[model samples]
Target: MAQQKPTKVMKLYNRVTRLPYGNKIFSLMVSRMAPYFGTIRPLITELRPHYCECLIKKRNAVHNHIKTVHVIAICNGLEMAMGVMAEASIPSHLRWIPKGMSLDYTAKAGSDIRCVAEVKPEQWVEGDLLVPVTAYDDNDVVVVEGHIKLWISAKPPR
Candidate 1:
């Protein structure tokens, strides 16, 4: 099989990650492109093929009545990580859209949260792909765990 060209998103990430505060710049760019993700103000710390990680700071904007990070805010971070991971990992001929998500809240999100999304190399193919996601609080306790399902398909010929 021919080597797949990098997606525009992946190319952008590669270009920015080398500059000073590049991760922050990339995160801001993504938030601008997808306004909803700006709600959580996610700071992408790492992005690579099949993997992505981001941090969501604890703040009033994202806090719940209980003074903890809201579940919805955490979900937004997870989805952002998954979207970037898919963009970086998928073959050039393929495209993906999120289908659904299933999650379990494991603990209170006190303090900043680190969100991660991952997919095994073998799982990248046409059809449904389940990307595993997890969020951890500052102390490394899992606050949320789930999978985001994505429908993968061939891109239309130009």
Candidate 2:
């Protein structure tokens, strides 16, 4: 057969630079945490000027021995959300990378997972942006809340 068409996600990425970056960020995560997020495929569901949302369905592979979401998988969701939000908020002229992150997992993720990152870009100054990420379970319970700190690098890092 002829080559298959790229996915809808891939089609959308072609028209959006930030989304493509976020996609790359997700793909790169396997190296960031191989055994934990071994085949992480985050899909950007929504992206706008001030907000972003990504999603990853929960599978047995992501569950811990107790059948709860693995801690590292929660970390993966947190990072994906932050990346999407950062892509939406930061300008292409400026480069930024996540320097630090803080997370609190309050609830256990039990089913398909949703990661939402929302922020008021106007509230940030020139040097740093705090991307807030919230992950919820299938029942809409907040499983985790976190923030990713990104360092701006339009110029050389000081």
Candidate 3:
């Protein structure tokens, strides 16, 4: 009998990321923490096979003394949106990761932030996946916009 592969446990940036090593887990790990991963903590709101959304609130931890949302925090949210979207846009038999992220801060985010990343894999064949991200403030005002370019590997390039 073939032995069952034990479920993998992933630490969410440090805690809570556990159970099975899927693309989502990897992306979350990569996006959430590191000396270079920035310091803002992003919360994953939706995880779908074709897209995902994440959210984070503007607090002193992610704000400047002026109470304005920090630019880096916005970047973190962008990365999460991109990562989740990319994960959804790819086939399970395939592999890929983010190559670049371009962002623009349009307005001030003075409250909770929400980032949505959507994908259409069927619309893509052989090329980069451009996941457009739009972040909104509590009042539904557009606070940031960005695009994350992901290079889909031809194979499982672990």
Question: Which is the leading candidate under lDDT?
Answer: 1
- Give the residue spans of candidate 3 off by over 4 A: 1-38, 156-158
lDDT (10s digit) by residue, model 1, range 105-156 = 9999989999999998778789999899999999999999999999999999
Where does candidate 2 have its weakest 10-residue lDDT segment? Answer: 1-10
lDDT (0 to 1) per candidate: 0.93, 0.66, 0.66
Off by over 4 Å in 1: 1-3
Q: How large is the C-alpha RMSD of every model relative to the true structure?
A: 1.3, 8.7, 6.7
Candidate 2 runs further than 4 Å off: 1-38, 156-158
Candidate 3 lDDT trough over 10 residues, lowest sum: 5-14
Which residue pairs clash within candidate 2? none
lDDT by residue (tens digit), candidate 2, 1-158: 23334433344444553654755564444335444443545555665555666667677777888888776777786686666456545554466778888888888778777788787645444577778888888889998888888877674455
How do these models rank on TM-score, best leading? 1, 3, 2
- In the range 26-58, model 3's lDDT, one tens digit per residue, is 445656443333355566666654566677777
What's the TM-score of each model vs. the native?
0.95, 0.70, 0.70
